[model samples]
Target: MQDEPTPIELTKAVADFLRSDITPLITGHQAFKLRVAVNILDLVTRQLTQEEGSDASEVERLRALLGMDGSVTELNRALAERIAKGEVDLATPGLAEHLWATTMDKLAVDQPSYASYRRELSRGE
Candidate 1:
């Protein structure tokens, strides 16, 4: 539905330019600030690239687990309420796997380099 240089690509370009070009021209506090900005941009790019598929998977899992249809938010809320009421727990079918997959997707956007994520990722290989 869109053209080349998609939002994620453009975001990565900006982050790359800031990291490779502008960062070297700055110093001390400004450099640190720029690094943080670039990091945020990179995170945004990752989220833009991954959010759709991750959300789809989450919705599918929630639908199957809840045995009903609704928006992702609604399904998640239902799941939360079930868990709170002791109707669902880690022992519930697919619950742990769904939670782990969802958390991994979030970490892929928030902190891909996190040690626990890295370790878990390695185990899948």
Candidate 2:
């Protein structure tokens, strides 16, 4: 790995700079696009920082729920197949909790400011 600032840190810094500096100077469509760009950068930073831990937790939950060993992608596919066949679902032990955790992790990265996400996050604490 490289030294000093991580990729997430660099991206976050750039996004912060854009939000604090460039965003106020523009107007109309350009400003909207700039905001979108900054948001995208922030999302990327979150994913870079959070994905590994969230994915590992998801894999562990999947292994416990399914009683199998595989990569995260494989386990997820198996889970989806089982769900489609009515073999595994919310009624299954740990299923609902696992799904909720995964969804919350995604929302944390994708839209932390979303009202419902914020409410659920606070409720968890």
Candidate 3:
């Protein structure tokens, strides 16, 4: 009897399928999917930065973008909550600056809210 594929192999196969076939099949949905993906990516990018040190201006800016009128602590708590709830997924490509910036540009027109938030956070205000 043939052995079944391992979990890792299965995951890789699924990823291959998504990129090679499934994604192309839904080209019409690319714009919308890209927007959602970028939004989630931006949120994770900001969260990763917080680990380096406290960026007060960034915290305030994220709060404004999220429409949360609260102190930095409250904002952090809310972000943590959102992450825990699966409202944000951090596994997308380009966790670093360059590629992520490109992805943001590609998707920004459709994801204005994310773009706005990224602008605000980057401004250090």
Candidate 4:
């Protein structure tokens, strides 16, 4: 029987993808998007690896870093909703792509004008 992959392996795979594949595809404002996504993923992975029990403090820290003011419960609920809606993709060889897609989707949804702004920005208009 084959052994299941460890969490570290999965996280590493995602990190590798972000550094090796996704980073090169980003340009202009999308570069910022990618950077934010990578940062979030790194935080989540760190919490998962280093902490036991629920990582509410880590989530709260992330929320604060993102300029969100919310309880850990609220942040977790939002993450769960995004995951349920297929906004976050966690099934790739690396979770990084899913994280990036989800972050972009959330940003677009939260700020309806963001996509247009990014498009214009990318065009250097």
Best by lDDT: 1
Query: In model 2, where do residues sit more than 4 Å from their true spots?
Result: none
Instruction: Identify the runs in model 1 with alpha carbons over 4 angstroms from their true place.
Output: none
Pairs of residues at least 3 apart in sequence or in different chains that clash in candidate 1: none
RMSD of each: 1.3, 1.3, 14.1, 15.8
lDDT of 4 by residue, 21-115 (tens): 98998899989988878766666666556454334444544464334667656765775676688865545233453344444444433443566
Summarize candidate 1's per-residue lDDT along 1-125 as a digit string, tens digits: 88998898899999999988898899999988998999999999999999999999999999999999998899999999999999999989999999999999999999999999999999993
For residue 92, model 4's alpha carbon misses the true position, in angstroms, by: 49
Q: Over the stretch 1-125, how does candidate 3's per-residue lDDT look in tens digits?
A: 65777444554555455555655456567856854554555444444434333445545555554567776568767756766787644552222332244344434333446656578447662
Alpha-carbon local distance difference test for all models: 0.94, 0.93, 0.52, 0.59
TM of each candidate vs. truth = 0.93, 0.92, 0.28, 0.38
Ranking by lDDT: 1, 2, 4, 3
Which ten contiguous residues of candidate 3 have the minimum total lDDT? 92-101
Question: RMSD, model 1, all Cα superposed?
Answer: 1.3
Backbone clashes for every candidate come to 0, 0, 0, 0
Q: Quickly count the clashes in candidate 3.
A: 0
Q: Which clashing pairs does model 2 show?
A: none
Q: Give lDDT: candidate 1, residue 26.
A: 99
